[model samples]
Target chain A: MTNCAKPSANCAKRLVNSMSVSNDAKPGVNSYSLRDIDAVLSAFEEGRLTPAQAFSLFREMGPQFEAPPGQGQDAESSNASRLREALNELDSLIGLHSVKRLVREILAFVQIQKKRARQQLATEHLVLHMIFKGNPGTGKTTVARIMGKIFRETGVLERGHLIEVERADLVGEYIGHTAQKTREQIRKALGGILFIDEAYSLARGGEKDFGKEAIDTLVKSMEDYRDRFILILAGYSEEMNYFIQTNPGIRSRFPIHIDFPDYLPDELIQIAELMLKKREYKLDPWARNHLYTILTKHASNLDHNAGNARFVRNIIERAIRRQAVRLVDKENPTREELMLIRREDIGEGL
Target chain B: MRRCIVLGKPNAGKTLFVLHFAEFLHAKEVTIKFQEPVAAPRKGTGVDPEARTGSAACSLDPVSGSDPGAHGRNPGAGFGPSTSEHFKTYKIQDAVRDLTGPRPHTTRCLQSVVLELPAGKGKKTVELIDTSGLTDGIHQDAEIRRAMSQTLSSVRAAHIILHIIDASKAGKKGAVEAMGDVDYQVAAFAQMRGGYCILANKIDLPGARDGVKKIRDEFPGHIVIPISALYKEGFKEVKAFVLREL
Candidate 1:
């Protein structure tokens, strides 16, 4: 083989693995197929082939090269499997029990409707317009993104990406500009999800405000697109409830309402650990206790929005920075010195 | 539909690439939407006779609101009534020849053509937008300036950005000469976003191989796809990138 094909030990390892998989498969299978793909990829990386050639080669390999079980069956089932993988990912998240259950319910409801449609039975329309009431950084946006992917996987949406916007993005200056701006956003979110953060603000600035115009435009788009796109209006629980109650039209339109409660202290700690683990760092016992104590104090402070996952994320990130600062001068730091976040680095309260 | 907006300096073969890429994707007929910038709403605002002589004026029926046929006499210089929206449906061949030429700033507005690519199981429709060329300094022409701002807005909204650079220019000299300050600024801004790729165009030209090499060196860590946009030689990669992104 050319040196280009074996650029790194990683490539050689994948080749060995592919050779094993090829051997395990029935005879007559192309044993060199995976290696061929790696070779072409490396060649393209080295500027030996144009993108057109690489793409055609990739397309040719799509059918002939068999991926190991659970990797991906084929292109046809990839979308569905991708959706399943996303759900698995959601389930793997630290907390949000109620959120997971609600997602499962939506999936089951959609699947049943699909079956009913196939059987010629009368099926109810799936109006997925949702109101997500939560404090800041409570995984509302995160869940909405995953929901977009899930909806796409379940055939509810065509393009399951998320278009996140705020009141400023929707409400424009001038008389007719707000509607134009709002409609532009709606048009962009057509085949996916329109996530309106701080959505209650759309009802603020009085009845004559351009926010009202944006709300009107949004309502019209909801009716026009109907099932074409999913609109998720997210905000604080109390404000969102008030906003919905005042606007009778909004209350009647959004059928699904999900409330994200603040994460408990233990959950926050779990989240911190996960975040630290992801970055190849670990919280020592002393730092772990410090984090738990800080989280408990903050959660008990009744500031509801005091510290959630975002707060944990900030503290962990800060600790990582502090750790780096503490060790940057060392000639050769040990593995533990590099990976550990100590108690002193926790700093004072937020 | 996801939007893949094409942006670059003037005469970077953006129009040719859009037309040819659409054709390569098997578009029988394309519905082109020309979103004329709201700037310069007045009639006959910046028409200059000096720039009107080189190109031939071929009159077709007005495709949209109020007759814009008044400028048919001086087609090159007087793009009259460009503030109003227009739609043109054309076959690939006619579009390729008519939309692309040697002149700079041929596309003065946001012109988008919708094309579909067959994804794994289904087809994905994306609007491939062609915009006015960007310059390093502020352009003196009001129409070009308006279109430049329009292109910038489209850049912000686009999920996938294909930054087309003239490889022939870069090949002969260094990237600093071939690319402009605006090109670097645009690339720098787009670097933070995902689905941004640099297309080194005019690879069929004599010096383009070196230009592609220079582009790769200049914009390290960017996905650079080299192609002769005129011949649609590297469309498969563009297609794959768009499909993966969308």
Candidate 2:
């Protein structure tokens, strides 16, 4: 019967109801988080908690108390910021403009589906299984990793970590071994994403091979654990197209097909520079010019389907080694001298 | 299962409205489940002395919503425990006559009945509960006080709160059914919950029109359905609201 439980009547007589305007239009059942409020009021009535004690228990029942703790320091705002933070990482990647747009669309679609579910409206089935078609290093794995983070932030997935495997991991050497290996990979990928790199190779041996068993296993697991994990098939675009065409069942299953287009030479240069900056190194003017020449000629000189990022990583890493060898004999290299990579660092021609 | 609770001050037609609402949902008989107030154990947070410091005004944050584990708790920590539960099946008309009365605080314990609502393709079951009245100040009778506390606890856990206010007695400045601090507290506490709505009852009585308008004007932005609990006038809107929320 203390004043804390019963406030002055006149104080909030004209208070405007902000419930309708708050919580990002979700203004639904999430607003009044349960049981804790009941527990407190009853405790107060039972005299276990003082009026003052009950009042503050009610106060500590803040907005994000419902959000699972330990993941976010400040749950309410940080969950939202994490989504943006994940998206910003997506945007910072060089090229893949269409991938970025499509990612945003997928995010919007996922968010709308959740809202529709909240409202009891008919939400479209969340079939997020996707086919990522691109040559190696067209940011396929990078985008997949980012997608997992974005999905986690949106509450779509639990762990959001990536388990990457290729054909050898799924299609084993002998008979029943393929299914066991595939199942093990699927088990490891249950909460997050199962990224199958060079996915088309599983379909390479045709109907008579053990690869067919692996495909059947993957498709069965996708159905067996729908909504539990997201399956991403990534490889050379043409081979992926042929793979989907032959296995007619796979096409309908993965509704989203994102084609990772090859980065233009200029775009490749930008990617290389970004990579250099991340490695705490800078390209001298001569070295930048040398990189531009090598990448521009890379189309005719190198294997067409080799991962673009992989090739750049190869060149950058090799250059770092060559630069180390060149500066080894120096009396004492300045910070700038150590940081810079000269044209001589580049392996000539190849 | 969404729990839609009917609550208000004593003699505000809460019991009648609940029975009428049950009938409105096409129930011929209602098996009412009676539950007494039981203390739920507080977990996840340690007891702190600072709980006495903050303002008591309603902050609609869901408390301990993260405890999916608490879904399965020690027996009585959920609802009814220790006390023997009484399940009485009464025809809709018998319930109206037997449960409701003109005297204040007639309905003491928590009484709830499950009614099915037509939602899209399949039907959904919503529990409609009627409870004892909440008063402005502490009452001398410990039984009534405990019942009021039970009603408050039910209101906290309910998915939808249908606060039944008597329109006929609303206009007078100082009447038994006059809006008081308890009403304001309930309104503010339920403000953040989307399933909260007001039902202005006794619309069949004279002077009830003014009461409905006054109720609407006083609590702006709230959906107030004017209904004669005896006549079941605004039962359609109530059903639609329930359907949408459930």
Candidate 3:
């Protein structure tokens, strides 16, 4: 037999109103029948009604359910853990000492601004459009990607994904078309960072080219979106400087310019070791020395586009493949032999 | 409108093919409808398809009279109630010259143009949609990913799928491979559906002949047409395919 009360007008409202007054069940619910209570309870249990709906129904039947506290605290802690993980990932990256420091500063600034907003204080505008000047294969793209994730974790962006486009993605062939092309990319990058690689190429096509139109569209979008999205233009140092010099408006729009220097030979070696460590591979003493000697040679012969982490990656990957091939013919190879990259495995060229 | 979607990786000449194909059909004015991802009032991920802003009407002057066989076949095509009358016409030369570029990912959002091809005593109206490029692996940009997903959904709804591959760049290192994993997946998925064709674009460039062989090798059972989209080289076959499918 169910314990529901008899039906009456305003019975649901009265039961809900009496929830804060008493913890006793059926104190105000005298109208509903036992069968009605059973049906409603089963509906709630079957997921037909939401918690709030079920609670309201229970209250109307003169039963009170108190939700325990600490749920907010649990959510906050989980968010903090995610943020910690993202920052730790950023810290684990090799080199880019200055880049890490800049990211810390930005995070602190954003945090302070958020705190100020809660106190009803006027906060400083955070315009994070930046210029990243470096050689090819540097950590511009990598760091930008990390920063996007960090920003998303910290609530600075709705979605912290990185959209990487080159000049070809931005510039259209004819007049009025460049704006459409650039705007489309911008629209896609609304809640994230628009990392334009080789951005200087937008200015390379000379006068009457649609590159200028693309630039104009980009600037307009930057102004329009403001803090909603971060735009990071990356390119080689000299060409990027020339690009900004020709387009004076760009320098003012991008207040943060970070110059990524080439990694030293030792730093490159550290990066190489880190890469190898990630793959659970080891280098023999002879192979390590050979790798160092090759690095030294490449460092000496560095061109404008040299000093690349990507080059190191290629070398390591090739060495791993070579090592596999080397051990393939060996009968009953030991575990140590399988894990090691020998001197011959390290290729001659970078 | 019966939708024919042009899809591929970036720099695959999808946009060029769309405009040149429009020219092939002798469309005077092309109204391009841009389907942007705008948030809905009730649901967060709800995409209201009929936002209908920023649509451009391009006038198509210098209509091609070159195809004697395809010309004057149908007189009253694409004027039915099914055809949308709101599009702007563009000149054929102006549209071709402006629409085609040496860029990747030029068309980001879904841009649909209603074009009519002459058929037996009438015309068939088809909505030719140009979409953003889809790259293999995960894209870092949330916007690009969203657009790509949207493009995929659009692909499922489209009647005809024209998959464009840059024939010139197919075999080149760091270029769009002749048959990338994503390409293979899309091709295989489209196999279950109707009217899917691969357009081996940019045959005017060097190494495209090899690209053709590579494409044929990768997509063994599919129809692959080799053409220079810039010169309208293999548009006749494409038109025939569209006609047969539509």
Candidate 4:
């Protein structure tokens, strides 16, 4: 009944609907007994009552007779679960324990600061200029992209796109050219994450280098646009620490720092399994053994590509291609044969 | 200014409704702006119905021509982008005798009258447009086909739509006022916009009540107001609706 009360004119329709339901049970459902319906019809006939009033009379007859439009996803559900979708993607990564913990802490801090502002309390500014200390193929770029989605869902960025740039993309060849190039990239990164890979290389040149001009432009724009964008400087741990020590202006502005650690041999195998599961491909026992050997051999090497998930991803993708080639001459491959990556398909080199 | 258009089948008394509505708003003199018809622009959407508002307002005797199609059918060449318009002002009685008739195509061009309604502290201008009647299939006359095309374009752009349905003849299947695919198309198109109402016209005649009920059943979730356009009945509710939207 209360549901019908919400829409006043719709009452007439609701009452008419319920009156039919009562015709089976109540013996008084005859013409003379329904004086209320007669009144509504007469008012409707004379054009004396507006559409809303007539609908309300319909509603006044009855409302709570049936289940209202059952078990569907209503439009007004909270956005928290939608935001959790991005976080779930973040959590589902095979490794990066420390990175996930730091992300949760940063989100908690930002949420609390916003709630403080809502209550008229003194709130901290959300300066999430981050420094990512990691090596190549260590999931730094991937994490940056996920962070962009999370920040956009949290209302920190209008467009959660990631724009990747290196020192060459930021620094220019001539005088006054570096700032122009850097500002253009910054313009593209506004309302998104600006990921500068191998950022320590920006300080590799002498004091009079164009890289200095690029860094200065970045620091100035960081303050000018303040919360309009997020910037993440990524490099090796030692080099990034040294670079931060040399540039005093950038140290205080970058309040959050996260480290993308290399995966262990076991975690690397899990990542390969997750990737294969996502592609709907599977490894036979022998091929799985071959993958374990390849991963364990590279586990202690500590090279630029050692203990990296990207290396495993490339191997899986190449093996899939090799499997496709192996099956092309056959009359028709079954679904299992088509999806299987065999022992002969695995190769260390491209 | 937001446009509120009136559309229906021919001889449905759409012209009478517009004039009586103007008089209902206390309009003493009605200045009509008519855009001369061009070759029927390739049918409908995204095409601009070039509604040429009058630049020169020439004075005419209160009663100028008794012929309904005199002002609209300017025999000028009908191509290109340049569109000419004709304007005339008339008292309510003069407009009724001249514009409204039992014939189907009395209004052959895009005719609009700008009326003001009191909003908050000032008056808000609304251009009330009367369009040529639409038919279901291929029209015999090319000029009417052009006018119908113009009506289609105007219906797409107008902010408010007042679809006039002839209640008296709605029960008769073969009559001009019978519900057709064109009426359904208008209702379907207008459902997306903000202000759209169905005025079930000619309610003073018999069989109109059943017709109104049928209209309500056919197009559920629409506001249907039964009105006798010639008698000026139920104009107050329409005015209130227009003012609320304004």
Say which candidate scores most in DockQ: 2
Off by over 4 Å in 2: A1-74, A114-122, A172-177, A206-208, A305-307, B1-184, B192-246
Off by over 4 Å in 3: A1-75, B1-246
Q: What is the per-residue lDDT of model 1 for residues A106-181, given as tens digits with 9 covering 90 to 100? A: 9999989767755557888889999999899789999999998898887678788899999999999999999999
TM-score of chain B of each: 0.81, 0.82, 0.77, 0.83
Q: Model 4 off-target regions past 4 Å?
A: A1-78, A328-334, A348-350, B1-246
Tell me how many clashing residue pairs each candidate has.
Answer: 0, 2, 25, 8
Scanning candidate 3 chain B in windows of ten residues, the lowest lDDT window is B76-85
Give the local distance difference test score of model 3: 0.69
The candidate maximizing TM-score is: 2
Which scores better on lDDT, 3 or 4?
Answer: 4
Docking class for candidate 4: incorrect
lDDT of 2 by residue, A1-350 (tens): 44335344222111111212232244443334222464445344433333223323333453222211122335538878999999999999988999999999999998887677656688787789999998877889999999999988876786788999999899888899999999999999987899999998998875678999999999999998886789999988889999999999999999999999888778888888898899899999989998888877776665683338778878888999999999999989999999999999986734
RMSD of each: 21.7, 12.5, 26.5, 17.8
Q: What is the lDDT of residue A313 in candidate 2?
A: 79
lDDT for position A146 in model 3: 83
Ordered by lDDT, highest first, the candidates read 1, 2, 4, 3
DockQ of each: 0.02, 0.09, 0.01, 0.02
lDDT of 4 by residue, A1-350 (tens): 12333333444454444443454445454333233433343323222232234433433444222111232233214446657888998998878999999999988887887567545578777788999997667889888998888887676676779999999999999999999999999999987889999998999889788999999999999988776788999998889999999999889989889988888878877888889999999989888888888887776666667778888889989999998889999987899998898999986634
lDDT of 4: 0.72
Give all candidates' CA lDDT scores.
Answer: 0.73, 0.73, 0.69, 0.72
Instruction: Name the runs in model 1 displaced over 4 angstroms.
Output: A1-73, B1-246
Predicted complex 3: DockQ: 0.01
What is the Å distance of residue A180 in model 1 from its true position? 0.5
Clashing pairs in 2: A33-B62, A136-A307
